[model samples]
Target chain A: MAAEQGIDPIHQFRIEPIIPIHIGGLDLSFTNSSLFMVIVLGLACALMILGTSGNALVPGKIQSAAEMSYEFVGNMIKQTAGTEGMRFFPFVFALFMFVIFSNIVGLVPYSFAVTSQIVVTFALAILVIAVVIIYGVMRHGTHFLKLFVPSGVSPLLLPFIVLIEVISFVARPISLSVRLFANMLAGHITLKVFGAFVASLLGAGAFAVIAPLPLAMTVILTGFELLVAVLQAYVFAILTCVYLNDAIHPGH
Target chain B: MATTETAGTEAPGAPHEAAFPPFDPGTFSSTLVWLALTFGALYFIMKRVALPRVEGILQTRGDKIRGDLGAAFKMREEANQAAAAYEKTLAEAKAGSQALAQETRTRVKTEQDAKRKALESELNEKLMTAETLIADKKASAMASVGQIANEAASAIVQHITGKPADMTAIAAAIAAAKV
Candidate 1:
């Protein structure tokens, strides 16, 4: 069993620098995660260029796919946030494509899952929260504080309700970042474990007879992992909308 | 802590390092650097390419909608003008038809009056001719009656006195008839 192979799930989160590069006494090591980030960015840029180069009304394949993605994000924003919310459409759309693209690229062989890291997810979530907070305050002035105060509440229950609301408001970024990071990390770890099982079973002489079963399960897990990758990205974007909703329309 | 140490001792290949030491991602700074690079590129694309194209599409769509609405309004105005002109022409035609009918009636009445006057004059001439014939018949009948009486008287005297009456007797009888 690979359990004896001395590779634990937590140990798999190890970071290794691909290239040693330093600037001004900073340990700026280009790691595997950084490599995946570059690849994801390249993918995004390539897709954009290909989708727009033709720009045909009738739509070739790339144009149609791009148009579909654009309309999908546009509709999601409109449905959740309304027409007034379309102002944030570009940000939300870009976030969705970037996260999804990174997750999918991480699935390739010898690739590092950048979204599996807390730093990346936390940074994105914090940025979204900051934007919402700033936008709410700027647009609504001091009344933006009302986001933590439910309207029409009895004075007796107001304090308790406000306390709860404040806690929930503060928990938004933590929950958003953790949800995406945990899903990505757990999914990749599970796939890695199952893949190890299939490889080890096939490598053993007598247990090679049972290798096909684990191999089939590994294949199934791969499909499920792909679905999770896409779903995690979707969940992250939808949470952003929900948080932004609080900013745009305060309180319960 | 002692339990974790014992487990690590039992595990032959496990690292002997402390578990509490937070992972110093020596590459964290590098990740940030790369992320900044990518983020800058994305921001550039958003500001330069993607955002502009999307905005252009929306603006052009809005202009098309406005232009179509304006054209429709102009067409409606033209249609209304055409309708009004058609209505005016129809009214004028009705007025002309009415005037022609009135003139026809007036002319017919005048022609009917002239025919009636001619008929009346012809009837008056026939009535005067009848009256003159009746007066001539009356005068001739009176003269004939006087002659008849004179002839009868002469015949009677000729039978009694075997002689015809004289011209003076005939003249005296005509004068008595007149009285």
Candidate 2:
């Protein structure tokens, strides 16, 4: 009862500006979220650049990780969008590393979750869709519009089907961004609530006997959240490749 | 952009005073800028350096594996060729030895036949000489036996008549008795 009153699950999500900067009617202040992005950037780059520095035919641990990640993303793109989609491998790989590192880093005790923000995920999602749209238009010209025109549809339902397809296409970014943001947001909030339960239980004097239950649940949820972290990164990357596939082969 | 002042005002510790941190549209510019910069750096590094190096390493490893496999197959083929050669040599040696044995057997049989023929002809010559010597000795012994018998008869006549016997008459009587 006391834990529920004292718990502020939403407090962890507050994005405080680490270094405030205002320029030309823009508050482009560097926040905790930006710092984590840089951290993810460093980690991904370092792993790719330095881990492969040895260029070992028989790889060490770090090199194995780098090569495995490369092959994993390579195969994922190849499978989703075919070999022609390999052009977007770097883009998809960068996205995957950024998102996965963002998620994994956020799992640390006091780290900021960058992908948990709507703006951040939305930006990534919009970037993916922008590429798809630009490439589809440039490559296929007027034929790219055939994506919304499903085959075997009757004339009566064609307009309604086209409208629905367009709506879904427009909603892709929103859904993609919201899925990531909400998952991280909800999982962390739930973890915090359970942790608060343990803390409150430990403080409740007589109720301390049952504190281990919530602590155990938090541990289990952390593992589950770790899975979710990796899974979300995979989903985000594969979806990007799939959309790019649509661009590369628009008829399907 | 107009809400920059409002968000800047909310930049303090009490961020929730105005809006939930994520939904606050004012922070978009900052976050997007950072995303673009970091993501752009990652892409540049990946495209220029990381991906190519890994691809090269993979390519080298693949070539090495194929080379090693080819070498193994070549060695096996050489071994098979060597084994075949060895088998051929062994068969040739076996045939050669058999021919040598057959040649030795035939030569030894021919030598034995010559030696046996020489011994048989020499034995036949020796047998003929021995038979001639035995016949001459038997003829001489028979002449001596006749002389002894004539002497005994002369001596007996001398004792009975108290007179010498005649040699020519005796010889004539002996010849008549022999007939």
Per-residue lDDT tens digits for candidate 1, residues A164-245, read 9889878988899898888888887787777777677777899989988877887898898899899998888888887787
In candidate 1, what are the lDDT values of residues B78-99, reduced to their tens digit?
A: 9999999999999999999999
Q: What TM-score does chain A of model 2 get?
A: 0.96
Q: Write the per-residue lDDT of candidate 2 for residues A1-252, one digit (tens) a residue.
A: 223346777777777689988776666688888898889989988898899999898999998899999999999999999999999988899889989999999998778888998877887888889899999999999899999998899999999999999999999988888999999999999998998899889999999999999999999999999999999999999999999999999865
Among all windows of ten consecutive residues in candidate 1 chain B, which has the lowest summed lDDT?
B1-10
Interface RMSD of each: 8.8, 4.1
Candidate 2, which segments miss by more than 4 Å at Cα? A1-6, B1-16, B133-179
Docking class of 2: acceptable
